[model samples]
Target chain A: MMDGSMALPFWLDALIALLLLGGALVALLGSIGLARMPDFYMRLHGPTKASTLGVGATLLGSMIWFGVGHEGLSVQEILITVFLFATAPVSAHMMARAALHRRVACRERTHGEPWDEMDRLPGYAESSSSSDSQR
Target chain B: MTATVLPIALALFSLSLLLNLYRLLRGPDIIDRILGLDTLNVNAIAVIVLGGIYMDSSLIFEAALLIALMGFVGTVAMTKYLVRGDVIE
Candidate 1:
């Protein structure tokens, strides 16, 4: 299965290689930041941004590689790209809202709480019912 | 060069998955774990696409697309449940 794909020119191959390497490394860095960040809010920052850009770059490379081939521009991967860009922020927002609703612990340096923001949410209710606290 | 880099890229992505696993396992709170899971879903798409390229097959991208849709829905559902104590209300 590995053999028989058409050959790519030198510069194109190099570009694809660069994209793959850089994307992979950025993804790893983001996951590392996700694991090591001090607060749950802080932890949310890295992976959301990293995974989108990292995967976007990698998919761009894939698109270019397959686009130049015999099938003439494989258009399907763009669906994944658009889907990711559209959803990353939505999920990040949802997860952030979840954190605030639950009043997840934050480090001392975390500035003002979004307690007001949480309170203003349409269905916001205090975490009094959530008795399980790691806080 | 493409040949050399593909396996290295694959290895790097695998390592990234491991780090996401660490956060998923050890997060101090539920949101962090959910974040880990969300990030894990996003990164897994990249891995599948890369594998598709290496295998010279385009069939697996359907799986990647399925993953993207489900991941978003799952994240939203869990977060909604967390906030409102219900998924559908």
Candidate 2:
């Protein structure tokens, strides 16, 4: 089955290639940011946004490739894309909150974090450890 | 062109995965590790989808979607547990 974009037009194939390559590069940048960033909040920006966008672009490319070249409109790719778009920020927000609750260290320039955050949490105690939550 | 580009793209994503693994292993703190794991999940999904495209099979889309949902759920669950001592009340 020659359903790949090659069976389509050269221009269409180029577009697919661009999309996949851009997505991959963006994802690589995000992971580089993740591995190299100095602060937790700084690190938060990497995977949550850039990585999500990277994956989104790739999925979009695949969606078009499959939709046109292969089967007719594979909804699963779109579902994954939208679901990831919706969830990335939510998870990022929750992770930030968790980091704050656990009082994870921030970079020196980070501002607005309350030093007296011990009482900020409703159930701070009765837990295992902030460094690593109990599994 | 896609013949050449596909493998290149796959390699880039795998390198990204390696960076994420480095972060997960060498993260200074727990949140960083969690972030690493989350990024790993996202990249892994892309790799799976890319692999599907390479194989010219749409069947793996199901696996990609499943990973997407599970990744979100796992991230949320871990964050929730960290935010509060309990996952469910």
Candidate 3:
């Protein structure tokens, strides 16, 4: 079909490109963390913190596209950015705690006993102090 | 027109989503799956924004908002379950 619609300005297009590129890079990093990080506790830090930022960047890019090209403010993307920011951390915290609990349990089974926090705390402190002295 | 630009952005976003999917599938631990799932939700929201751009309709924005809401609540619920092993408690 023949076209009469106004062309998007160069700046607007550049903004969109920047958004996608940034978003993709964020995702790539999260995936890398998922692959490279060792153990559950260590791995938990990567995607929840870093990738949330990445998605926000990408969403902001999309918001620019919609706002400049289509109508007024892209409120939906704004809302999404807000929601993602709020929940990503909460979820990661829960999962990490669960993983930690599971790890603690797993260790107990292997050792044929559970560690009491009260009993272990002083021993842990003394050993830590001794190790620090040796260092 | 924005139409031409929309597709390229959508395609790139889709590729990101697929990459997240691959991570989800290959995750060696439960935390990886949770991370992958979070990425997927973020990508879904991105797609909704892209949809609005592609169609030049503000209506798609509502869908994006809903996705954002659902994704957050769902992630929170899943995380709670993982920790407490109970939805209410």
Over the stretch A57-104, how does candidate 3's per-residue lDDT look in tens digits? 777776676566456676666777777787777777667655554443
| DockQ per candidate | 0.62, 0.62, 0.35
Location of the lowest summed lDDT over 10 successive residues in candidate 1 chain A: A126-135
Model 2 C-alpha lDDT per residue in residues A13-130, reported as the tens digit of each score = 8888899999999999999999898888788888888899899889888887888747667778888888889988898988887787777887777666633455555665434355
RMSD score of candidate 3 (Å): 8.5
> Runs in model 1 with CA error above 4 Å?
A1-6, A120-135
Stretches of candidate 2 off by over 4 Å are A1-4, A111-135
Candidate models: Cα lDDT each: 0.84, 0.84, 0.65
Clashes of each: 0, 0, 0
True contacts kept of each: 0.82, 0.82, 0.45
Alpha-carbon RMSD, candidate 2: 4.0
Q: Tens digit of lDDT per residue, candidate 2, span B19-66?
A: 999999999888888889989989999999899888888888889889
Clashing pairs in 3: none
Model 2 pairs whose backbones collide:
none
Interface RMSD of 2: 2.7
Q: What is the TM-score of chain A alone in each candidate?
A: 0.80, 0.78, 0.67
DockQ of 3: 0.35
Per-residue C-alpha lDDT of model 3 across residues B1-89, encoded as one tens digit per residue: 34455566577667767767877888776656776777687777777766765566668777777876776777767766765566674
